[model samples]
Target: MNRKTLVLSAVIGLLAPVLAGCGDSDGGSDGGDAIVVGTTDQYAATKDAPAPLDPAAAYDIGTWNILRQTVQTLMQIPRGGGAPVPEAASKCGFTDRENQSYRCTLREGLQFANGDPITAEDVKYSIQRTQDIKAASGVYALMGNVDALETNGDSEIIFHLKSSDATFPYKLSTPVAGIVSSKLYPKNKVRDGFEIDGSGPYTFKADVKDDTIVQATFTRNPNYKGDRNIQNDKVELRSFKDSDSMGKALDSADIDVMTRAMSPQQVQKMLRSPKDGIQLTELPGLEIRFLGFDTDAPAAKEKAVRQAVAYTIDRGDLISKVYDGMAEPLYSIIPSNVATHTNSFFNKYGDRDLAKAESTLSDASINTPVKLTLHYTSDHYGAGTQKEFETLRDQLNSSGLFDVSIKGEEWKNFRPNQIDGDYEVYGMGWFPDFPDPENYIVPFLDADNTLNSPYTNNTLRGQLIPQSRREADRSAATKTFGKIQDIVADDVPVLPLWQGKTYVASHDDIAGVEWAVNSSAELSLWELRRGSSAPAA
Candidate 1:
């Protein structure tokens, strides 16, 4: 398997003509200056997609980034992170005495971009839809605690949990639980087409096949009766086939923002070049990257083997090389900024101790002739991912611990292969749904982890998640996840890599840029103001 690349050039070109038309409403810029937002791929609205549209149902980071920016949800995390504030809701919390039931009061008269009223029915439809499409939904498990959902008197909606899930409200903050207009969406089927019926800050104007995705002036929504962290009137997203093209386009004033897919070396270069007029917004991410070993594979079955492989990795070097000092070294799958991170792995493995790797393998009667294949995705993460994996392979081969073979697949096929345990070892990433400690411990470490790939400590999955979810006091919940991290570090099911910082490169004309905790970071389009021209370097 090799890396998969899906280039959407034609779609971008078709959308580009209206790039300067951010104010014209008729699809031409009369705002004096249109903010040309650049991302790697063009937006294509497929039929029957959910409210926060995701092209690949498996939840790729890029798709999530687009969805969060393009759609408005019930609640959202503000810049600098803490408690989530209401976006569509006036105020959302528990109504029942036991806290088993959660309720959110809807903002009055809110309407979707297509003019459909955003009622409690839309919220119900959105939550229920996730379960209805469980097989295709990456967020099915996130909604498992939801035993029942009901709307009352048109203003309030209720959620009855199977257990007293303390973080249930936080889960609602995610886009996966976003509310969409029931009028335009089918309760049982996702509608197809290129038009958006979302209630976001910016409305979709045109998706010209491949070249660009254009949006016009933001009319202060009469029903937009809730809190939104934006101050911009219009936003236009221009997609390029690759980062190289996007960089050149930004340099030539063809686009006003460059958000993703730029190489670390390129980012460093831009940071040094005062004349480039590129702004980099770096924020700590809830995401952590790691290598998932196929414990079921004969070669990886023994603890000695996995532990030896873990010891061989130089995480610091990998971070510097792959992320250009934009990411922090991670010792646990749960990153440092998250609540339950433990450095037991870092203490145990230390800094790329090759001697320990050799001794561990030797003690287990394993020798140099050992070999296994590692896999990654082609276009999902940053540009240096392939090189990162190549470095890992060479490191292991050089340590004389194992002979490694490298392979990669496109994002679409990459996920299936990983979940199916088809590779001897594979790399994967986790971005927290909410900024909670439980979000870090529960999903990937759970016994029946969605991947179904086995790990040593089934106790964390079997016992910890339930216990943590049931705790009324969140601080008490911390103990459960903390214990989980300790056990997981000892088990060594996966090798911790790095925690990345999210960065966005916008043309100097775009302003009020910020970052979100969700690795699928959202752009606060309303807050963005475009100057008459790009700022002088």
Candidate 2:
């Protein structure tokens, strides 16, 4: 991993009473045998659940987190940020000078939880099945360049690509590339239920849901042959509706740890006054939040109107007032710390100049008081989203150059509508599946992107991206990324708003905060442990 690992440097100044622990109670010296964690409800409800736990079908963060721990992949992301290292495979790398052919040799004696031998054929079958399904939301698009997979004996496997893709190995580090037992999964269709046979560190024990909560339990797999050390015998994951409820649970010691979906206000409050018995660890800023425009929309079709919208909004105020400085203003789709990230948008539209916006609109013959409706999810981006959009509405309307109205929807409904191009303009957030600049560039620029926007720049889609993919030297590839950012800045298909920092609030006695956050900015539950000093509930 490239970034330095974050650790619990200080305990909460204030002290609170410890409570009796709940759930499994096999031991008390190390805070008990089971650890309970809480997150937002977004993780629990699956819009497509009846289907099997197919690694190919798991797209969202919540499902991917679970799959990453339960299923093995060719390569795995390091704890901090850096290039992926081999996981199930003993070693994997490009074998041809063209950067189109890759090979992997698996470690011997690997087995699934059910005792099925893990072989090179299993790896080939897993990749083939995912590509064969061609699911709309699956990782097929990322692996589009892969032409064939061949296995030699039971240990060596080769992947031939249609074109050079230097980022292909990074794709192997994602949950979508999880290798499954061919004996357990079907080749033609998705699995019908959650019967998963994996070769990772954890085994799925049970998943249950009710009206108010969804819970999943996992146990350490005896067959696991990986680097991760499972500290707890079992881990229980619980999901709540919002941060407030989850915060209440944390206060009462109902949950040992809480990660993701906490409101900015809650995080700020915790930062100001440390609550006794709880410690907050702020992770690196690797996430980006932006507003995407539907290019087909009548108002957005004009490039001047889009540029005007971008120029009129103030990111400085949004960060200080709305986000409480928890985030930094973003000028590009790629986050700042990443290589090749440029401040293209900020260079073009400096300090939110209303005069420039007005001139752009006037030059394009776009009428004054341009009407636009901004769509956002009230439930998804935490409680601050409503105020964030409201602030945006105020900024645009105060300029006297536009008339803006805002609408709210839940994430489930909001995502589909945005993907279907139902909203003219909408707010969206992105967490990288892999820690690379290509991960930031390809998803939005690809012709078959999830944005569903009508805007298509063939130069970017066909030429520049492929050119960058062939360049193995990342530093050398920065020039191509710079050009791509300039194009995106000029087009204004999406306006980068801010990059977010990850936070994890855990009981003071809980250990391994540093290892819990992986390179991709996702929580790694297997790394969590309880200190011996923690009192058992």
Candidate 3:
């Protein structure tokens, strides 16, 4: 959820008003037949940000959650983890041994909700628009390997890559590559409002206020033709300002499902006593949180200073104190479940050694009590984040190895300044672009990485990442990934913190809660449906 905005959100100037839940729009959609879901996500538009729903412009998971209902990509990740399968396409694969060229044949007779035939040209146009608009927050960077997009007749499209990239099919599964009608969307700019033109499982419509979507409704698309089985006749996505409101909405049956931004305290409470008609499901998570440094900034420029901070702070404390023991300590940027994951950070620093931290600074001839400010986003992560950073500050300050101060800002201003290199150190959370170890390594270390930090590793970016991507069987890249993690630990550019577990709370009558989200962290609302009669509100 946070990862999508890491690159695109810097332009989001002011945090939009919190989600105003289904005030009165229920009308007739809240019967035993319809479903309502609540979330804490809000979209704000400034002079720089494109409309949040345009697939070409939106890089956010929340925005993509809404788009996935209406927009179809050429390929889609299945309900569970596995290789991506055809969604809009009839068949797709690399046509060459080098993995540099690929082709896809479109499903015949695929039509948009408005009844426009979706041709191969439309697929090329939708993807090319992302590159053409050139929004700073857009996923144009993900398509960096593409040399050209070619269309044949009306059913086939081909992508010619600049280099071998076996992960290209995984890229096609993301909504960033969502296909749209060529005629309705602008060729060089994002669509200006909350509207979608695609051939997915559902059709979307919404009411906007102050440039943010206030209410959204999705209905089964009558013209839809895809792999998914639509679960309900109608679904309403409501927005809440905080977890408290979202929790109350679930309790009162104002919303049937709650997800994405619940507080850790609330989750722990829910686990203890899940209330009378509510059930909580713990889905496997790939979400991770960590500290990223602006290596060019004076506060962390010196290697010894970064190393000292790493050695002084404790990651386990962040879980026990801040998260109420809800997350697992992350020893490397790559989560432990990933293949080739080693405790590089733990091996290098060895569990908060104060004497070692002090000696590293002293050995470099650097001054004691290093002054630095750690920055975090006020809204994006969750309610516990401010306390998380405060705990980090307390750990470093208590060690007497550094003078640490903390700064908190809402997602709007926080992202831009982080992008501009205004903060010395900042907090970030990531869900993978695809369910692969390479997604974790390349995004923060590469030139086109989403962080916008000045940290650089030519070997990892140019050689290691490319080498991993070229291996068609992902499991065989273990040695290369092993070397990459070691370098990340040695460089101390990004300090691994914790890996989070996903908690989705819903009414007891709701079905498909477990199947609604996949390992990639994409929310598939179409998988959800009303199993029994819900309370009449």
Candidate 4:
């Protein structure tokens, strides 16, 4: 069977979490075998379900996390951390010719939990559906370069692209390309509150109200002749409104696993106490917490002024004090452990050189004291963000060159205002779309940058990225992205502040631990196992 992969354009719509389920004891004469997972997000899912368990339409990371339990992608970077492996597809590789086209032959007998056979047509339908609804779908942006999706036969699908992109396969592995049932999805646009059909290891059993969700044991699909990474028989996910309550849930054993939002202070406390029946797992996260400047602001438009502000703020101090050692000092937009990341910004800025900042401002002759307003999100990121910003204000104000005022808003209004150029400066963070240089470069550097921060650099868009992706050799990809990073260091439209270090606390009963650096940095539900008996207490 010759497997072919193709790109399709489409928009994915995400609905809030509807009302959320399940039971089967893992061992003993009693019967409560399901592994219970808890999260701190206040999810609002719908009661009735829809067809087309499509990953494209779903946008929120939380929703995608749950969908992964029920749907399989072509490849997944194992949650336990390792190279990407085949999941739904049995054997997948690129064409030796042209280097642009790719193919993935499906494993024979792969069927949805609902018993529908998964075929190449399903993959084609999933890709084409996103293209069909591109205008309204936020996900269409990810598939901008997809040209055609051609299926060779029943088992094989071939993807032909406008250009050769090494990262294309990685994109296919994301939730955005999750296959949907062609027969179930409507030909027209899906409304906001629509339900979805899914084909993964587990099936949705009952849809309760705001109380909780219940799932049931997923009989192994005989057709599931795919990857062997998943090892769990069933899973139960319960949602909470915040981290404190979720922590209490874990304490009471209301849930067996808790990887919910934990405050830095709480994480520090957990790390200190080895006897808390909680284990903390830390991984390099593909997240960059940043301070963004509104380039339109008169003071911000000047390079020296921006450089001055960058210098006055101390990253190491912030990490030690504000983040409680939970974050790593960051100088590049791309996290340090990833490919193409360099300390170019650090080389230019030096170690909190306040004098250099003053000297830079002195050279710019920006004698006119410039007052700037800095905005931040109160709920998002961690709790110490406000103190971090206050420290920034103090440093800049003490320079006697800047007059600073700080304000904060909830995430809802904060995002729109930043997009609209509402404030002089603000804080933001990024979780990669996929773990590649293109993900770091394309979204923020492209001339048509989606964040709309006016970071239009033709050299980055027209030359740097294209030059990188066209290379047949993977090693050569770094040069182009490296140049883009250098440009970012010089331009300084957005100052990289710190790299997020992901921390998870789970009960000793939970085993088969796994995680990765990208946005979906959680234990893969399929691999989680509850101990046969109560943990040693």
What are the lDDT scores of the predictions, listed in order? Answer: 0.64, 0.77, 0.78, 0.63
lDDT of 4 by residue, 11-86 (tens): 1110011111112223211115666676654334332222123465554355566666666777766443334567
After superposition, candidate 4 runs with Cα above 4 Å error: 1-32, 42-54, 57-60, 79-83, 96-98, 135-138, 187-191, 205-225, 294-305, 359-368, 416-424, 447-450, 515-520, 532-537
TM-score per prediction, in order, is 0.83, 0.90, 0.91, 0.81
Error of 2 at 46 (Å): 6.3
Worst 10 residues of 3 by lDDT: 2-11
The residue-by-residue lDDT of candidate 2 on 336-441, one tens digit each, is 7777889999999977899999999999888999999999987766678899999999999999999999999977667667877889989988887776788787
Q: Choose 3 or 4, whichever is better by lDDT.
A: 3
Task: Supply the global lDDT for candidate 3.
Answer: 0.78
**Comparing 1 and 3 by TM-score, which wins?**
3
**Per-residue lDDT of 1-537 in model 3, one digit per residue for the tens?**
101011111111111111111111111124345688888877666555647778776776678788888889899776555677899998999999999999999998999998889899988988888877765563676777888999999999999999899888878987778888777888887887777878888888887788777668888888888888777777888877778998888877888888878899988888776566666666546788999998998879899998998898888777899887468889899887666678999989987899999999999999878899999998777788899999999999998778999999877678767777788899998887776777787778887677776788889887998898788877678788889999999888999899987777777667666667544456788877676333221
Better TM-score candidate (1, 2): 2
Query: Which has the higher TM-score value, candidate number 3 or candidate number 4?
Result: 3
Greater lDDT among 1 and 4 belongs to 1
lDDT for 438 in candidate 4 is: 72
For all candidates, the clash counts are 30, 5, 1, 40
Ranking by lDDT: 3, 2, 1, 4
